[model samples]
Target: MSAQKVLKLSDLKQDAAVRVVIDDIPIAVVLDSNGEVHAIGDTCTHGDISLSDGFVEGETLECWAHGSAFSLRTGRPLNLPAYEPVPVYEVTIDGDDILIDPHVTKEVN
Candidate 1:
């Protein structure tokens, strides 16, 4: 599997989302309210809206185009309009850099 370079941790602001392409998969990199980073599929299960343009509230990422909210950690849909869970990636902190493994099923190393 080929891992793709997404972004640096320093480039992400707290409570913000960034769109990135990893392994040809469009992913949303979110920095939660508590300064935690999460990686999830960019596609919104409710609509075609990109989750990267959404709002980060606490551990949930709210879709900007709709009202649906999702858990950044588990990719679970937390609100209406979306019942299916999106794919979540494993994240690792390498110094000041943030690394993501989109194909991994286990905890990030």
Candidate 2:
């Protein structure tokens, strides 16, 4: 599927996460303090909670309910309670637009 414009780059705040649903696929869009944009699955593997409602620490998004931190780059859980890694979508920055394809995800090693 082609990438869809989810939000404007200026719409994101540094070190925070926003929830966006594209084609019924929920995703968490984050703009780190380093000024890099990342897209990952919004659901917490440990619980039925929105990762976007959680905290952003460095390159990880911590689940508010279980305190499981998921990597923004790889979507891997950095801590316990969540061994499953979430999907990480590739983010395309076109000027101020943030594009993402929900069907396309980055290969994490």
Candidate 3:
């Protein structure tokens, strides 16, 4: 499927993560303090917890359960207990809308 509108940019709070599901895929959409938008897999690789429920630290999203921080850009875990990186999706902005395609992810290697 092509890119779909997940939410409006205005609806997002700065440095906060908003969880959106597209095609049964859970994604965490974040509007960082730098006024940049990011989209990553909502599920934490270390635990099955939702990353949206975690805290946003700079450009990283910290999992609330185990304190594992995942990079908003590369989706790599920067802490212990989460050696695996999550998927990072490409974000598109049109007017006030944020679009994300679940199947499309940025190369992390």
Candidate 4:
């Protein structure tokens, strides 16, 4: 499972977010407040809402389903109703393309 696809770049805008699926995993690639591209699981652990549709603040992706925010880097659930952490994927920028590792480990602490 070493397939990689270019999604977007980091020189675009501050509120830029892209939703992509790789290796059958849904991921939301977003540029955080630190101007770094981060990848997180699209599904919210609190419910079944897509995190891509939620608000992304800093490195934490807020789940609109239950307001459960998860860290884009560590995938740690930071809100209520979602004690479980979502998955975070590795992101690499190739020129202007954002490559996301879809098969991320679901280990959250």
lDDT for each candidate structure: 0.84, 0.96, 0.96, 0.75
Q: Which ten residues in a row have the lowest lDDT in candidate 3?
A: 100-109
Tens-digit per-residue lDDT, 1-109, candidate 1 = 6444568889999999999887677889988878888888899999988998888889988898878999888888998989988888878877877887778743422
Give one clash count per candidate, in the order shown. 0, 0, 0, 1
Mind giving the per-residue lDDT tens digits that candidate 3 earns over 12-67?
Answer: 99989999999999999999999999999999998899999999989999999999
What would the TM-scores of all predictions be? Answer: 0.89, 0.98, 0.98, 0.85
| Model 3 C-alpha lDDT versus the unseen true structure | 0.96
Worst 10 residues of 2 by lDDT: 41-50
Candidate 4 to native Cα RMSD, angstroms: 2.3
lDDT of 2 at 13: 97
Collision pairs in model 3: none
Which one wins by lDDT: 1 or 2? 2
Regions more than 4 Å wrong, model 3: none
Task: Estimate the overall C-alpha local distance difference test score of candidate 1.
Answer: 0.84
Q: Over 4 Å off in model 2, which ranges?
A: none
Model 2 clash pairs are none
For model 4, the stretches where C-alpha displacement exceeds 4 angstroms are: 10-12, 104-109
Clashing pairs in 1: none
Could you give candidate 2's per-residue lDDT for residues 7-77 as a string of tens digits?
A: 99999999999999999999999999899999999999989799999999899999999899999999999
